[model samples]
Target: MKHSGSILIVDDNPDILIAARLLLKQHYQRVKTTDNPFDIAGIINEQRNSDQPIDVILLDMNFSQDSISGKEGFYWLKKIIEQDANIVVLLMTAYGDIQLAVDAIKAGASDFIAKPWQNEQLLGAVAAAFSHAKDKQQVGKLTRQKQGLNQALNTPNFKFLGQSNAMQQVFSTIEKAAQTDANILITGESGTGKELTAHAIHQASMRHNQTFMSLDMGAVAQNLFESELFGHKKGAFTDAKADRIGKFELAQGGSLFLDELGNLPLEHQAKLLAALQNRQVTPIGGSKTIDIDIRLICATNDNLEQAVAEGRFRQDLLYRINTVEIRLPALREHSDDIPLLADYYLNHFAQKYKRNLTITTHDMASLCHYSWPGNVRELAHAIERAVILSEGENLDVSSVVGNITSNANSTNNPIENNNAYDTFDLDILEQRTVRAALTHYQGNVSHAAKALGLTRGAMYRRLEKYGL
Candidate 1:
């Protein structure tokens, strides 16, 4: 097999440098030998700029003719790590200096090789070091992502709003659970603020200063599930052109919210369960298993118990994720909070549209009396639409409740409104909803898809089917 990585060798002995370069070049893609250790940093910077950075460095322990202290080797090793902690360094030492080699390992050297080492042993050590370097690179990348996500979480938005008894209970539960590292499972209908609940928990937790990563399990395809959640190395499979840091690693020392957990395929549930149980993940085409430390928070609309009983979900996985369950009540169940939620959305959208609009008592009552099947999300959307389309200081009650009241009086189902759909055909309903989302977002496919909770690829397929 042809190994694919750049290797660097640094030694004072010309013979050792030549021999090491020749042997490594036969296995690795690129090999460079340097007799001076001071030039190491310059070479690495050049290679990094050229996008061919060395993956592993082989360094001799001694430089001066009669010196056996290995001090120079330790100094250069520290330099290499300081320059790029992702680059793995293997220290070369005499058999008599084995203790020094151990010290080098403790000082961050990947491994060590004694003089007169067998060729097979040298090659094995180099291969392992290369793998270590790649893993470190992935970790570094994840650390950067964690930093970026922390910045994003600092933005002011998405407050959890409610004063009802049901919502008060949810707030109390979140306050209690936020201090612990226990796994949490949030159950609620779609758009009922399950993800918001998860976000609130993360922001309140001891890890609030760390990263908060979220994934919608339902959006990922079955074939990409493992790679998306557990990560994959370069060349792990077709089209895996580069190394990827998965959600579990990115959210290390923080919280990871797995939404739509019930939609995860049954066949793939075992893999997820295994990772959670082991608290480690092995990337595809990688030999090293990485330990993960994360507070997992999962949300699902489906009744997991029913899914487990029907064999659609793994019982073991459900038990693992639901260590402490918090269920959010649907909007209809807590209708008393409708006026507060509606006014909040009204003020939010009014400001967004730069409109000095207000909601009349009649319109507010109309919003509260309607049974919002789509929960808080639908209410928000309706208020936004009213704010945009209203021509006066008062929001148009007709525009806010036209479809809802008409459909409710006819069939007791607000979703069956003529604007969204006149019939009960699922395809037509989907088409209308997709069209409406596209319109709402001004034809931005990504925003439309996200608003509908569909992946961009899925949204594109629907658009093509409907010829939109």
Candidate 2:
């Protein structure tokens, strides 16, 4: 793909402008030439407003005949940098003024080319300067992406939860797919490590040095889909106060992971599909289409094929994103890995809270045997609570899921009876479990709610329902 950059040449001689334009117009994405030095600032400002600022400049030292002192070039060079300090300026000097060109370099000029230049020399110099300019742009882009990633992840480091056979198969598929730019679709239940799996593929891929941008499709509002994913020009909408770079543009030359892809509204699916099909996207209220080179990775718990059959999703979009599909195994599917995952989280929580805890063989057995409806995430939270509540060095996760407290023999604890729930009454069991969670957490609603895999609002509704 051509680098997303523009170049400008300022030389008083019409012939110089014509020659530079003929050569550079083919190489750069956008090249502008003029015989007036005074137009520099206005052009720069215009380009800035368009969100496609001039990247490099070729300025002639002498606007008049027999004047190669380079005073004019130096004056314009300062003005150009004042407009944008990061801009690269290459000086155009007469053959006899090579020493003057050296002086120009010291005065903030990137490199100098003698008038009546060789084609190779001009192209090479411009290519080098443009590369340096792109590096500068990349640094600024990476800074923005860094801040975004920090806000999104919240946690310091992200790690896989286990080394089970199912996970090994995932790693193997990642190793193969990392070598290609094919679009990937990840299907898995919530907390099944879909994001981390996509991240692992990107880290092992060739574009690892570039940004790994992501968007949660479920969170984006229906009305803001276009502006959020395809960017927008300033004032495109009432809330678009400034020019915005969307997920597609931000993930240029890298990977874009669209989380909860199934939640995307049916009407907006076509827009996303079009961008992926054309490999380019136009911002809202912008006429020019920007070329994209993103390796798309999408994840969702929803069954997209079923959605498509039901007319809730576009089948064409599904085919576009799923060149390769990876379905993460649920915790129940790989129950043997529970011990490793549990131990890892136990040690992690122990260090985090400055608590020493050891899990018994019986506790480990319970962890492996139970059905983890919330997958690995539930296990981590459970371990954290165990570490916090354990008074002894030996860890007791006996109350991890089935109960809330270690008072297994308390006469008031109805569920602890050997014949508890003999009739398999779900309502009675749920009530006992809710009461136990509240009691264990000392009526801490939030903690109890999270322990039961319920949102605080849902917990409140249940509390009112059961009159607790």
Give a tens-digit lDDT track for model 2, residues 1-468. Answer: 555689999988888889898888777789998888999999999999999999999998887678767788889998988878778999997653657867888999889888789999999999999987888778878877875774454232447766788888988888899889989999876667888888887877887767788898876889899998999999988888999999999999888999989888888999999999999999998999999998899998777898899998999999999999998987878988889988888888889999888898877877776655456766777777778878888887864444423443455445554346554667657766776776565444555788999976788676654434
Clashing pairs in 2: 358-395
Winner by lDDT: 1
Supply candidate 2's per-residue lDDT for 240.
84
Q: How accurate locally, in lDDT, is each candidate?
A: 0.83, 0.81
Structure candidate 1, residue pairs in collision: none
Off by over 4 Å in 2: 1-109, 113-156, 403-468
Task: Quote the positional error of residue 66 for candidate 1 in Å.
Answer: 36
Displacement of residue 20 (Cα, Å) in model 1 is 44
Q: In candidate 1, what are the lDDT values of residues 1-468, reduced to their tens digit? A: 668789999988889888887888788888998999999999999999999998999988888888788888889999898988889999997734657867988999989899878999999999999889889889989888866779587333656899999999999999999999999999876568888898899989998878888998877888899898889999999989999988999888989999988778877899999999999999888999999999999998777898888888999999999888999988888999998998888888888889988878867777777766557876777777778878978988567547453344555342444443447768657755875676565444555778999887887677655444
